[model samples]
Target: MNKRSLRTTLIAIGIPTVYAVVLRLLFGIESWANLFSVMTVTFLFCLPTIVGALTVYLSDASKARKTSYRIIAPWIPVFLFFVITLALALEGWACWLMILPVFLIAASLGGLLGGYLKARNMNNKLSISTLVLLPLLLSPLESMIESLPGTYKAYTYIDIDAPADKIWRNVTRVMEIPEAEDTGYLTRTLGFPRPVKAELNYEGVGAYRKAIFTNGLVFHETVTEYQDLQKMVFNIKAHPHEIPSTTLDEHVVIGGDYFDVLSGTYELEKLPNGIHRLHLYSYFKMNTTFNFYAGLWGKWIMKDIQNNILKIEKQRSESM
Candidate 1:
C-alpha cells in the first residue's frame, strides 16, 4: 500500500478502540460498564464520516445541483482513515475488543463494493464473510449487556395434568416426614432428617414457610400474592450463613416480604398436568446497609436444600 493509503487504514481502524478501552476502565466495576463501552465504540466508528457525509450531502441541495455518490467519494478515504484510527485505539481494550475491527473493516469496504455493483447492474458476488459478520458481533455485544442483571422473570406456557384445585392441595400442603432415616447435628448433617411441615398463613398473602436447610438457613417467608395454585409470592428472611459480614453498624436483615438480606424471595406457578415452575426474581439492592455473609458451608447447605426440595416433593407426590 502507498504511504497515504497505509495512513488511511490506521486512522479508519484505531480511534474508537482507544475510546472504548478508556470508557470501559472508567465504568466497568462489573460487566455492566463494559457493555456500554462496546456499544459506544461501535457507534462512534460507524458514525464519524459516514453520518457526516450523509448530513452534508442532504444539507446542500439545489434544483440544478444534484447530490450524488461522487460527492461521497472524498468521504470514503476520510471514513477509512478514521476507522483505522479507531482500530488502533482498541489495542488497549479488553481481549474481547479485538474481534470487531476486521469485521468492521470488511463491512465498510463491502458497502463501497455494493455501490459499485449497484451502478454496473452486474451480478457482483459480495464478500459473504463481511456480509454475515459485523452484525453478528454487534448481536453478542447486545446479548451480554442484557444478561448483566442479577435476576429477572421468564414466562412460559405449561399444561398441567391435574386440576388447579388438586394441584393446590398438593402445593399448599407441606409434608412433615416424622420418621426420618437418621439422628442431631449428624442427622441434619448426614441422613434423612425430619421434615418440618410448612403452610401459608393466608391464601395469597403471607409466608408459605420455606424449606429447612441443614445449615441455620431456615426462615419463615410470607407470600406477596397467591392465586389458588396458579401463583404464590413470598420472601425468605434467611440467615444463609452462620457468620456475618465484618463491617461497622453490622448488617441486620429484618423479616418481612421486602426487608431481608441473606434471605431470598421468589415466586412459584402451577399450570394445568403436574408441572410446577419456580420464578426466583428479586429487585433488591446490596450495599453495606446489609452485608451478605454467605460462608462456604452455607452455600453448600443451600444447594443441598434446593436439591432436596425436589426429592421431598417427589416423595410426597408418590405417597399421595
Candidate 2:
C-alpha cells in the first residue's frame, strides 16, 4: 500500500477503536450515570455501525474501483477492534463469539451507507461526526427502556436401543462423564464447564439432585413430578454466587443477570420394536435487551448440552 493509503488506514481504524474503548470504560462505570450501559442496543448495534462508517469515510476506500472491495473493506477495522479488545481483556471470548456476526453485518451495512454518502459528495465532516457520536447520544434514552425478560425452551431427544428401565437409570443419575464422551460442540467451543456427574438421593417427587460440572459449577435440582420409567420433572437452579467467576463470562453466566436455566424434564416413550425414545427438555430465561437474538443462542447451547447428555445415556444404556 502507498503512504497516503497507509495513513488513511491508520486514522480510520485508530480513531474509531479509541472511541469505542472510551465508551466501553465510561459505560462500565457504576456511578449515577448508569444509564449508559454496554448491554444496550446502542452499544451492540449502533456503535459498530458507526465504527464501520467512520472507517469507510476516513479511508476514502469508499471510492475503490471494485464495488465488492468498498463493501467488504470496513469489516477489516471492525475485526481488528475485536482482536484488540480481546487481547486487552476488555471483552471475554464467549461474548465476542456471540456478537461477532452482529458486528460484521452491522459494519458492512454502515460501509454501504458510508459509500453512498461519499458517492453523492455529501458533507463528509458533518456526517462522520454524527455517526461517531450516535451511540453515545442514544444510549441514555435506550437504557431508560427496561428489557423485558423472555422464557424459552430447548428440547432434544434420542432413541435408545435399551430398555426403559436402563434409560431411566441413566437419566435419573448421570454417571461421571469421561471427556472423550462429551459431544457438546457449542458449549465446549465457548469454554463452558463440562458436566461431570449427577447424584440423586432417591427416586420420587421432592427428592434432591445435585448436578456437578467442572470449574465448580453445580445445578441444584428438586424433583417436582416423577413417574417410574415414564417421566421426571425437576426445577433447576444454579446460583451465580456459588459458581467460579472464571467458569463463564458474567454476561453469559448461568443464573446471572442476563441468562438462566429454570427447569428440566425427561420423558421416556416406548417406541415400536422394543426401542425407547428418551426426550430431554429444559426451560431457560434470557433477560437482555436483545433477547430475540440472545434467546436463539441460549436455545442452541441448551440443546447442545442436553443432546450430549442424552447421547451419553443412550450409549451407556445400550451397552448394558
Q: How high is each candidate's TM-score?
A: 0.32, 0.96
Candidate number with greatest lDDT: 2
Task: Tell me the lDDT of candidate 1.
Answer: 0.39
User: After best superposition, candidate 2 residue 96: deviation in angstroms?
Assistant: 0.8
The true-structure Cα RMSD of candidate 1 reads: 16.5
Each model's total of backbone clashes: 41, 0
Q: List the candidate 1 regions with Cα displacement exceeding 4 Å.
A: 1-164, 178-195, 206-218, 238-301
List lDDT for all candidates, in order: 0.39, 0.86
> What lDDT score goes with residue 126 in model 2?
89
The local lDDT score (0 to 100) that residue 240 gets in candidate 2 is 94
Residue-level lDDT of model 2, residues 1-320, one tens digit each, is 88987887788778877877777777777783467877778888998787777767666543543456556877787777788878877788989999989988888888777766666665777888888778778988887888999999999999989888888999999999999999998999988999999999999999999999999999999999999999999999999999988888878899998999999999999999999999999999999889989999999999999999999999999997
